[model samples]
Target chain A: MRISWITEDKHTPSVVEYGKVSGEYSEKARGEHTSYQYFLYSSGKIHHVKIGPLHPATTYFYRCGRSGPEFSFKTPPSQFPLQFVVLGDLGQTEWTASTLKHVNSSDYDVFLLPGDLSYADTHQPLWDSFGRLVEPYASQRPWMVTEGNHEIESFPTSYPDSFIAFNARWPMPFQQSGSTSNLYYSFEVSGAHILMLGSYTDFHAQSDQYKWLQADLANVDRTTTPWLIALLHAPWYNTNTAHQGEGEAMRLAMEKLLYDARVDLVFAGHVHAYERFTRIYDNKADSCGPMYITIGDGGNREGLALTFQSPASPLSLYREPSFGHGRLRIENETHAQWSWHRNNDSDAFEADNVWIHSLRSSKECWNHTQDSSLDVHDEF
Target chain B: MRISWITEDKHTPSVVEYGKVSGEYSEKARGEHTSYQYFLYSSGKIHHVKIGPLHPATTYFYRCGRSGPEFSFKTPPSQFPLQFVVLGDLGQTEWTASTLKHVNSSDYDVFLLPGDLSYADTHQPLWDSFGRLVEPYASQRPWMVTEGNHEIESFPTSYPDSFIAFNARWPMPFQQSGSTSNLYYSFEVSGAHILMLGSYTDFHAQSDQYKWLQADLANVDRTTTPWLIALLHAPWYNTNTAHQGEGEAMRLAMEKLLYDARVDLVFAGHVHAYERFTRIYDNKADSCGPMYITIGDGGNREGLALTFQSPASPLSLYREPSFGHGRLRIENETHAQWSWHRNNDSDAFEADNVWIHSLRSSKECWNHTQDSSLDVHDEF
Candidate 1:
């Protein structure tokens, strides 16, 4: 097997020394970077390496280059009950420290961030700085992520095409899961299947992402991984007023596919608030509908969105405007717990908690009738 | 092409999004780390991705994961006259800061560090901290390195094998050059070829390294890269009382090959002081001898080696007891300038300067008679 790392200098060769332990190492991987920019990495090419035949649930020690302390990481177990931490719209702010501290102590096995990561907004230096900021936690866990509006940073004439920094650094496992677009992909952890969808990209019926999503959902083998959870940036059912109906069109376009595919949960952010809906299907509560949770308040510079739609809709169960994150504890194939926390300037407290249990068997869920035939209601 | 970064966490997938300026972006290489330790990357798999045929001398913007600011690095210019800063025995001391600052502002192309990086000895945690310490300059430039005593950290039965941290972190281009040992390797930059040797490894005639060195020197096509320089850990011709003859045996075993190959310069450390040697072979001055320089004064926790071999030899041109680093500015095919800076607290000043010029053509120099017939004098 081999190892890897990133160098500010694009020309710097990327190498990683890895083995079973700290000293007794075996292989080295020397990989190359895709591109570079002068704002930070004078030699801006991202260097990488390929290595493997690795065993799951193993611990190994390695470093990026000749320097750095002996960094160590543990591989995931090839089985189920993966503990994951979910976050979104995270920015570096005085409030972020608390959310991060809470996360560090939460005993998470993996991390899922649905975009708006550094919020560099085209400020290249911020992107570099953000890496070090999260290096403590991100470097330790398998932090899976998707793009958000903030990640669509672009500069006039200089970077007019957008997501330059976003797509350049966060290379997800999209290709391995059958999607060429960095916007969407699928992976498995224990018995749960996670689909990271793209809200910033084209979601219309004619788009490639839509077709990929259909195939990805169609390919899921629920018996092996009973849980089907989808994550994206914009919430399909947010009660907050900030981005009240910002994603309404996106929802209308893809909601039926996810609903028909028997997606058990949908996690999203971008409203700068925390909102949880009780299995909503077209603005109404339906047991078969996906449990929708919006956890956008990961302590960003843009204070929390405190305003909600006047006289909250019946579909809304709980909503909080504060800086914090969410956590998912998958206890088994059919039972999982999710909690939304609000950071009172770093003193985080759980604002809401729920046990989401799948009602039908893996095969039975996917075989259920579509929302177009069985679900239609204006209120819970 | 794609961009990437090293997260302390292995399970954390590697992702780099980059584009020309800030917005115009395209590719993404989502990779995962190979191995992780139970410590930092409890998810012990170093994440990595492969991207590129990046344009030379172009800058691109990227972020490691969804977080971090947009960091940019420039690809090296396709052609040379590359200026590289050289440093050795650098550790995490207050004095190291000054040395690094001086080297950073020196405006060099690549960084050459010949071991004793963190001075962590066996304290592994220091290795990780040192990465951040040198990240500012290292990430900006390709900091090339070799093994030193500090990196030879080994444990009892658990890690009876030494350099565990070294090999795991710094995977040199040894394999590329036909050297199976990470302790030795060779690479080319612009018009210069660098040979990084290991002082801690076995260098006897029958050793793999010796054979590799013989083959490497024999294969150098100096016509393309007219500059040939070798660097190692222990100094063979140091005037300092500290480690005065630490590498004497190594010199006796390998000096003839280097001298015969017309390796213009030999750099080393392990003597906590700086000393510049006039062209010497077997303790005697010779016009064709490689200019040997010992720059082990890059401050570490171990204070400077103030004592010297009293009544210094005539072959020694200059010597200084201080903490600092060096710089090499290759002007053309035959001439290059070298300078050493002392970190006077933070205000750095040049301690010595010299212009080293290779007198004969690459082939002509190598054709010179062996040192044994060149009238070796111990009492020179």
Candidate 2:
């Protein structure tokens, strides 16, 4: 379990107390913070504390600030059939509330917030407020998040540390998972090992992330965890005009590694819309390439990106520009189901549904007979 | 471990998964909420999930709201030297920040927010906001709290659920602890058994609370948990002009029961200041009477109660009108220390310090010849 708080002295300590019950805690640990913020009249020191070696699936109660409400969380079960809630670009808005309402009732196991969390955009207070806004949901689930463009609130003339708020508030398990930066990391849960990559960081073949990604993929054991999923803020496959070609270069640089690793699915967000891509790589149908899905319309103030390419690619199996979230149920090592629910529709009627089957036994298989060149907007 | 969320309908389900590690959870339990809200512009269905039969002194991790940051908490160890923080009348204000800073730094195990959280009054939105404000602290530690005047945000006479907001948000373990109302409950830690009473609820001998209090105290096993601490909102013994005699009626009805039970200390708040009293009952010193300490000075915007009783009660030991909190360290089964700190002073200089020794075995042992009364208002 992780708990955090903010202080102004840059030295006020951060602590966490955890055990199986209240008061009788046998462990006491001090935590540290990274970066500082001096915005308006409010200044802060972000603190992060990690409590660990916890009993898997056991319920543990904890509190972050010295005297706040006690929060508890149960670790996920180690095996298959885990439910996962996937969404992106969830900002503080009425529509965001609608999306959360649906997501909260979905009864999923993992929450993947692929960047653009608060849309603070240099307005740091929004970031703090947004944390509270999502605490009801985020603090209660394993929200595996990544940095999006909006999280890159760079103030060229003032503070140089970008993602200051995001970094301080949500400290990912990067170090434990063998990644150097919170921007990217990997962790195992249920029957899948999730790779949360950084679209805002370096993606060159020689980059640290790339080398780590290669090693991480090489270490995956299909016998224990057969599902491999990669999450990034920007979609490599999209047919929407917004954020078109934004992640194309990155995809070109890293897609081969993922395909080689036999990743079953890739989730992303950025374009304020939803789109599901057919299993393909380098613009051609690939039986082994991971199926890509984008569900970015998470109720940000920015309305949905309604405009799609005039001539949609056959690879774009589904597209919709509406505020919603997705649910992925890993049925087993070989089969998983995905569903996208629009906020405006009935709770039972999914806007789109697809079942993905793993092809882990096939090694690096892909047919290059299709289109040689990929269209950016058509893949959104 | 317990978690919650909200939905439009009253039927949305609640769930908590907990065990040992992040993915080895063996327990999955569904939970439910009791009350909900539908304000002017907002609507909600509160959710509650409980995960239990947790191993004592062990750490467990779980989440609420379907998807959230996984929170971890350790069950309290079976026994002593537990640190308990005692404070009262805290509300959301610039002053509240100072109090929280000090309290957070003190590293207490149990946070006693004896009442007046948020200062939301009838503004129901502040209730939601208050939960987030104290979450950093309360979510970590076990904050044993009770209702104060501010929580008495009575609606129109037509509806008698005066504390609906407070009741919905802060659900105490009253039922689990044997009490029938969330307003009053008792929980044990180390050598101390804390009784959190409701000053707002009925306290007459015939009242349900009175009956419960009698049974709870009668059942205390002094051999194992030798210390008995009482916490309520309004100070039963105060010399401040504000809230003078506010708790007199209740005190008249319940003080003897506590005195007979050989209560170690009575902590309360309501007046906007801090005050300590020599052990006394029926306007006279009694070595066995519970020591009365009022640490209500927990940063509220209403400012402080500067005026004292004209002919200050001979029992008043110390009094101060300032913004701060107090620390109670149960050194052991026989000795405990208390300190009241001023928010603006150096950390080491406590306004008042006292080492209260237990007199549980010596019934009515006061040698009244010591002095009529003592006063320490001059010290503060």
Candidate 3:
């Protein structure tokens, strides 16, 4: 986890504490001094300091690190409304620029970039350019990123170094996932539990990530969080001809675990298009199945994926060949709104919009548990 | 000028012709042309097409469109040794990675960058992280550049963008000069006579750039394939601190006659890095400057200067606090080298080792004329 702070002055003398009670940090730090760490900037005056990597679902108290006066904050509640902006394949293109502007204008507390950032390799200049472009928003909010195929340049060496550089620049809940690697991790945003899977890593049953995923899912207290979100780079249910069946192997490896766990949402990108799917279980529409959304429209030079596999595809709800981004807003325990905005050269008002409601909250939604004999291998 | 010709297929019949000679294009374009201006891809089968931008340089013809193969190219005796690389402020940093690696590995006939590169910004990232970096042996030849202040960001902008990026990138004809705009312009490499002057534009008259510099340096002899090189960023020799003395109020405002005369090799990048100085003259750096290099180190997080100014004191080389970049080599009458590498971070050896040299034959060094009577102002 990375944290940036803003302070009014460097010599303002303040102290920071974290514990069960907002004003009782010193008591909590009695034995485990490792609970807190402090640093000071030498020359330029610091106006603020942001700290993170806190344990998921745990409440903690924190305060400034000086005498005379101190600012305190309670960790975000374990159960509260959470908002995330999801996107992929975003580069320094006109469409990406528009999506960023729109997202920034809206109220997203955090951003999730599921692969294909800056695009095709980690060029320092390109990354710097990307940083400059995103600084307006990231400087104020958290921007978490995942690796895509394009980000892999040299293996075993440069690739890992680039990832290190990326992690240094952006903060994420990497430690919460129990995996030391940032390529895959999980975090809880208020009442919702989210798992970010790493498609770039080995996903075999014997791999540590798969085992960790299973352990994580099994330990989740569904009665408390009530919602589970899984995000990855490759779409397991995509009908786009470009990457047809490309992720089938991965699906065969882990889909059943996610299905049985009743995951609420699945987000993915890679086909260079925007696509959303209705609830599906075993190749058939089922209200109980997790909703899957593909937001690959984040501006890339590759244009968009315009074709769908077939009209009879039960999972396919909407697909557009244009470029844009996605926004997800959770209003309560069982209702949320999702929107997709397409960015054309025209004015800003011409955005395509959509809203997705939770299955528990929608009385008209269909249930699929009655069909126990459905074959999961059949393609719609 | 560094030019890359990319296509989707290598076997597809294609030709490039200029003057009276024509040849089949040998390289394949990477990805589908996403936009009319850019070709996208990371790696694959690759090939190249090259030529010089110098006068009497190899005149050639090329056919890219589907209009059939009837293109040709020819050049007068003056156009020998034709290709070059243009770069700037390529400090040895992560910011300079992609461009440095690519340009260093590519077969650019020659190279050149104006100024402010490999800035010894700080001790750690500078000497240890960037200084030792090297790009194969391509830089061992003839690299030329001006100096900028970031070369000594530890000092004030006294180093100026001119000397910083310039010194690191290229091997200019003059060094260790006492003139304030020593960051300023004008010179000759190969058959091309180039001009480069510092940006401190405000202090026009008493400003060394104004008094010692002469306009209408020469007229291009079409029969001899004459090519002229004129370079400067803060154009005027006098102005405020923003642009220093760009000479905009004096020399630049009166450069139309020189533009009509056809000069080349005008390169500059300050306003916070990265701009291909237009091939203009009077109002533009245009084809008159035909090929301008505004390779401000895009990697620099600091603001790339957008304005020009005159020197505050004689020791003033530049007035901003930032980093640096570099250029490569200049070859023949038509081709010159250019590139921009930043001083970020990388494990690679010799981060700050960037250079440009003529590919054909070496020339004798020129003599410097010192003026003892000139008034010298001190401002460290």
Candidate 4:
């Protein structure tokens, strides 16, 4: 696992000491630090330390640098019955705090954020503050995220490259999965193989992300990881008017690949609203296609996207504009429960619920042709 | 060493068979490939094969994709007395052919390009042509290059990220040196420690490139690699009015780091002209700084930058608007010879020559304080 923190002193050494018990750190690992730039702003040293080969599902207490308060975290389990908290657009706001509180209501193995974390925009210092804000919950569970349009803090002539601060601070395990960019990557946890795609980057047939996704999906053995899920920023299928057709280009470029892979679910966040669609592909319903869901209403400053298209499409099962989060509890290889809870005055209200079957376990979709041909049969 | 090539067949096994002698194949290695996109154009499968652990400075014959004409390349010598042919802005044209013919006239250990290789400029097919054009010389010698602005074929709303083709095609040994980005990296050749910096990317004090440079330079021991060299796209100091102040921001951001490291030479491209500066620092003549050189005049189609500023700066030693190339021959740890050859109709004429002393070998520069204080003395 990799641990990252910031210090005001650039000269201080980056050292992380950790063990299984509190107040007794047995192992020590040294890390590296770098600085970030914004107009007339100078950031402190951002340090990252990677210490692993650790036992899964075990608690580890760690301290950053030589002298500091110790923090503890539990690694994700390697067996079944793991849970994941899925949310996005989690900016630093009072509602964000409430959403986090609701998320803390239950135990999750990991947090999957499609995009738009912190909403730093271009103010680089917000990243440091956001780090402090999420340290409480994020220190306990792993947070795997991809980039969003907000992460592209590109300044015209000064900073041409996008995702400078985000990439430097929130680097994912991309190289481990043969990915060259931090914007996209994949990781296997418990019985699920999850792909975090990049909607803001190039996703054409020739793009690196597309090629990587193809190789990654082809290498996935459905027997080991039966549940295959994907996440990106913009929703490919949506009834919301805001940011309409934003992801159509990406969908046109890469929808068939996911459809052919028999992906069970595709979660996206960008419309600032919550909407769930039935298994769909190419703007139509298909059993082999993934369940498209937009869960961007995680208490961002942009407020809720209050409007939807008149006479919702048949593919959209449910749609709402509210601050909430979702949970995916994988009970076994073939069964899983998905629930969305909306933040209310005192507690979070369960707005929607569903039980899903892994696409690998479905006779109709599982036996689909490996080639480009996708003909859903009635043999289920 | 990583060898890269292009194949039309995506399913063709990315295999390389090699041996010490002609056609006596003894070892084979498998590689990987990916496709590229531009408009409606589709690219061939770009293949990369990494094969090493063999003896350096030895000739090895190899064939690509199981069936092809056998090709051979000589690994760079691990010892001193190595030669590097340096040029940049090499666009495909009749003049480019002449420059290659001139470069092929002598036996060089490796080819060093500052940037602007293909001038593809959004036309992805041109990259293949450029690769084919340089195969004869490039296949035999290792070509070490950084990115130029021309490599940024970013189509807004489609290809937002730059250097998709350049990075995928010509990947340097960046990860081995702890660099996270392919835009910048450092390597050691013979008695020289060379740094390939990205002029188009972020170079502020807090940028990743700046921080990586700090770590890389601090780890360099002058006792072993006495010659320190740096390469980028834009020339920091130039008398030509064409690209005046183009590299000023980068120079202001990173010049101090290189100066403090006692870099011996700084090579740059972008301005289509050839100019060499005396050992200077901060727009003034100072012996402690590197001898800045602009050798972008390697037959770019845009033509040469013919106009030079009136009342030439005293620091600029030689200035010309001609198609030419340069050769840096490192004879030993302390001494080296630099020569520039201009391509005439019949032959490449030797235009400029200079003998350089490695900064580490100079008594005045060798004992400079480790702090930021740089006070050159006349204690020679």
Q: Which prediction has the highest TM-score against the true structure? A: 4
Can you tell me the CAPRI class of model 3? incorrect
2 versus 4: better lDDT goes to: 4
Strongest candidate by DockQ = 3
> What interface root-mean-square deviation (Å) does model 4 yield?
9.9
Tens digit of lDDT per residue, candidate 2, span A1-380?
56666655655668777667865566667777666444332436677787777766666676665655677666666677788899999999889988998898756677988888997655566777787788788766678888887786543223445676777677888997889999999998877989999988888888999888877876777678878899998789888866566677689889987876668899999889999999988888777688999879899875688888879989999998989889999888778899999999987778899888875534334222112112211232
- Candidate 4 on A1-380: residue-level lDDT in tens? 88888889777779999999998989999988888766445678888888877898999999998887889899988888999999999998898999999999877889999999987665565788899999999888889999877788765356667888888889888988889999999999878999999987888888898889888877777788889999999788878866666677899999988988889999999878889889997888988789888999899876788989999899999999999999889999988888888987344456888888888888888766344322222211
At residue A318, give the lDDT of candidate 1.
90
**Candidate 2 lDDT, tens digit per residue, B76-187?**
5566677777888888777888888788775566787788887865545566666777767765666778888678654321223667777777777788778988888998
Q: Clashes in each model (backbone N, CA, C under 3 Å)? A: 80, 65, 189, 0
The list of candidate 3 runs beyond 4 A from truth reads: A1-160, A169-171, A189-191, A199-207, A233-260, A269-274, A280-289, A296-316, A319-336, A341-380, B1-67, B75-380
Q: Score the docking of each candidate (DockQ).
A: 0.01, 0.01, 0.03, 0.02
Worst 10 residues of 4 chain B by lDDT: B371-380
- lDDT per residue, candidate 1, A1-380, as tens digits? 22334566544657766777787568676665676452222325554555566687777776665556676666666676677789998888767777898888657777899878997654465677677688777666678899987786532222346577777777777888999888788888778889999887788887888888877776767678788899998788877756545567678888987887678899998878888889877777777779999989888775678888879888888988878888888888778888876665343466788988863454445456333224322111
lDDT over C-alpha atoms for residue B116 of model 4? 95
Better of 3 and 4 by lDDT: 4
The residue ranges of model 1 lying beyond 4 angstroms of the native Cα positions read A1-5, A38-43, A345-349, A359-366, A369-380, B1-380
